[model samples]
Target: MKRRTFDKLVSFVGLGLAALLLIFAGLLNFGANFANDSVASQLENQNISFPAEDAMPSETKDQLAKWAGMKVVTGEMARDYSDLYIWEHMKGSAIAVMGKPATYSEVSGVYMGLVRGGSTDVEKIKQYGDLRQTLFMGNTLRGMLLEAYAFGTLGVIAGYAAIASLVGGVLFLLLGIAGLMHIRRTPEDATI
Candidate 1:
């Protein structure tokens, strides 16, 4: 093939790649926006909020102080509430029952043992049962909040990816255009 024709082929291929990248950038941007909007709207509807700074203890105050008294909206806020608030509350509830931080499974095990042994200590058995119930509810809510955090994190990652894609698309588009311009300047008789 002629050198000019070869240059044209390579140039067109580069242009094609640039076009694809640009399209991908657009799609990624759309996806990022949708995910962010959906996450924000869902969290807003839930109306969860951080505790007031005054209500927070000294130990947790510094970490949570920034968002104190604010409604949970972002992934970071969801994570703070789920891990710091819900997890701490669950641990405290467990400690009250078992004298230490314990898992729901452990409390349920004790409750089941009490039933199986036909123990007459109704109060002790009831304590375990109540703790298990409370733990179950806390775990459920914590799981949901963590899921929201994960979804929101995905949105955040997608937003970054979209920006990267846009930059890459622009770079490749310039490169492709430069390649076409180079082909114009390239002589017909040039062989490489």
Candidate 2:
């Protein structure tokens, strides 16, 4: 085959792979949004409180500021069958954040404005909201926590896809180049 013909074929394959990546990335984003919506709806039907800006209180806000300042440990905590991993898992990312951790205090108590996780046990959550109403009683931090959690989820997914795509995309691009080189060195009459 001629060099131009070979180049065109390589270009076609490259464009096809790029198109597929575009579709894959779109689907992943769509799925994430859908999941977030469904979980939110379910929580609402259950009458669970979602944290919001208005739900926050001065005391809880201060506590959150403190928690943010504390040395955050990013290691996995024993929760259930698999340990609940810390918010960030990027190489050294969690550790660095922990190095300057968010602050909290047993004294400042609870405040509203925190979002709840669908996966978190409802009962355990109530303990924080209902039972401890006397100690700390506001809805502010809950929403803030939930929002932070959602962002963490997004970061993990995007980071993994980015890393994997870089590896695969580079490998495929190299393979396409190698195929072109092979065709160039071969005689015109030789079969591919």
Please provide TM-scores, in order, for all candidate models, with all chains considered together: 0.92, 0.37
lDDT by residue (1-192, candidate 2, tens digit) is 566576658856975675566566566656555544544444344343313423323334433332332232211101100111122122123223234322233222321322233435555455344433422222233443355445446645765675566556666667666666665666765544
Candidate 1 Cα errors over 4 Å, as ranges: 57-59
**Deviation (Å) of 15 in candidate 2:** 7.2
lDDT of each: 0.84, 0.42
For model 2, what is the alpha-carbon lDDT of residue 107?
20
- Find the 10 residues in a row with the least total lDDT in model 1: 54-63
Query: Taking the tens digit of each residue's C-alpha lDDT, what string does model 1 give over 121-158?
Result: 99999999999999898888888888888988888888
lDDT for position 4 in model 1 = 77
- Model 2 segments more than 4 A misplaced: 1-8, 15-138
How big is the positional error of residue 79 in model 2, measured in Å on the Cα after superposition? 12
RMSD of 1: 1.6
Model 2: how far residue 37 lies from native, Å: 24
